[model samples]
Target: MIKSKKLMYQIIAVISLGLAIFGVITPGFPATEFVLLCAWSSAKGSPKIHHFLHANRFTGPVLNDWRNGKVISLNNKIFSSISMLLCVCFLFYSGLNIYFIGFGLFGISISFIWVWSRPSHV
Candidate 1:
């Protein structure tokens, strides 16, 4: 049972890490949240991966800040807000449906507020 659980965790960590990497390259996808999930799963499954993520220069500070406190850097906040706004604009122009547009706007608004509410990393 323990071994299976560890394997499951490792699988989840790897998948989350892959998505996180993709998110870094993609415009709208959020990477930080996926990295946090990867780190959490790795901690349970593989110490090696956990240590590496913690030590990594690019992702280390982000993971550390988020783990220690729910902090998002000012730059990240700005970028995410802009990206979300752009997405909302696109959704509005898409003309899928009034209900869909309203739902999308509502969700985006909530996400925008949550992201901005987090403490900005200094």
Candidate 2:
């Protein structure tokens, strides 16, 4: 990779990885998608980071499942669904504008559908 391109990939890897870690703790935030992004970028920019992700006990299985066939386990699907539901409930009760709530509901609905559509196994 060109120097600039490599640097760009490294930046993406670092940012996405950080978000992934954050998502692990934050309800309604996404981890798998960010981890996938980090892994893909790191593969091109920093093999060491890529290796570390694969070797990680928590992240490794998610990455492996994704690589196999974009599988999202049943437990994870259930967890995500509950998280989204809670987020939507919070939004409605938080007294946000109706338009903003509608927009959030729309986005959450789409995300819910996509996550459920993924296979549970290869």
Candidate 3:
């Protein structure tokens, strides 16, 4: 039963990631939610995948750091920060004024900071 649940979670994570990836080219699409969902689901679903993510050469450091409860990688942290910055830029550029998006960006930024700041052994 546990294995089945894990498998289902893995499937959900993969599907969510796929959708997030596809959203990349779709206008007005938000992929971050799906990516986050994938991360969360995988973290709870399978230790193997979690370990793989933790040890991944490109993303492992961040994953492991997250698992250990440490700060996110400088690269991911910078990337996230820049993304939020771009959201602000886009908001200003469009002049349409969707201020709520800023809140989401801010929230995500805070989440990253919180996770990264956790002890490096979580």
Candidate 4:
């Protein structure tokens, strides 16, 4: 990759990783998704960063399972599902537009099904 493209990808990876970290600290944020995004972009932009994420104790297993078989462990499924549900609940009570609530609920329901549908890493 050209220097500019490399820098762009690196920036994306760092931003995603930052968001993933923030998700860890904040409730109802999807950390794993951002982590996966960081891994992918880092793989393209910076092998060292990819290796670091894959070697980290907290992140390695999830990355390996995903890379190997697109697996989502049952524990992770439960955690993510609950988080998503909580977000929807907040949306329902946020007094936002009915359409916004409906859209959020619909999206969460689809995502919930999709996440639960993934094969577990047995």
Name the candidate, 2 or 3, with the larger lDDT value. 2
* TM-score-superior candidate, 1 or 4: 4
Q: Which ten residues in a row have the lowest lDDT in candidate 1?
A: 24-33
Pairs with steric clashes in candidate 2: none
TM-scores, each model vs. reference: 0.82, 0.93, 0.55, 0.89
Model 1 residue runs over 4 Å out of place are none
Candidate 2 per-residue lDDT, tens place, 16-116, comes to 99999998788777777899999999999999899999999988998899999999988889988988888898998999999999999999899899999
Best by TM-score: 2
Model 3 residue runs over 4 Å out of place are 1-4, 19-40, 43-48, 97-122
lDDT of each: 0.86, 0.91, 0.61, 0.88
TM-score of 4: 0.89
Number of the candidate with higher lDDT, 2 or 4? 2
Between which residue pairs do clashes occur in model 4? none
Q: Candidate 4 on 1-122: residue-level lDDT in tens?
A: 59999999899999999999998776567788899999999998999889999999989999999988899899888889888878877897799999988888887788788788889974
Order of quality (TM-score): 2, 4, 1, 3
Instruction: Look at candidate 2 and tell me the lDDT of residue 39.
Output: 98
In candidate 2, which residue ranges exceed 4 Å CA deviation? none
Name model 4 segments beyond 4 Å from true. Answer: none
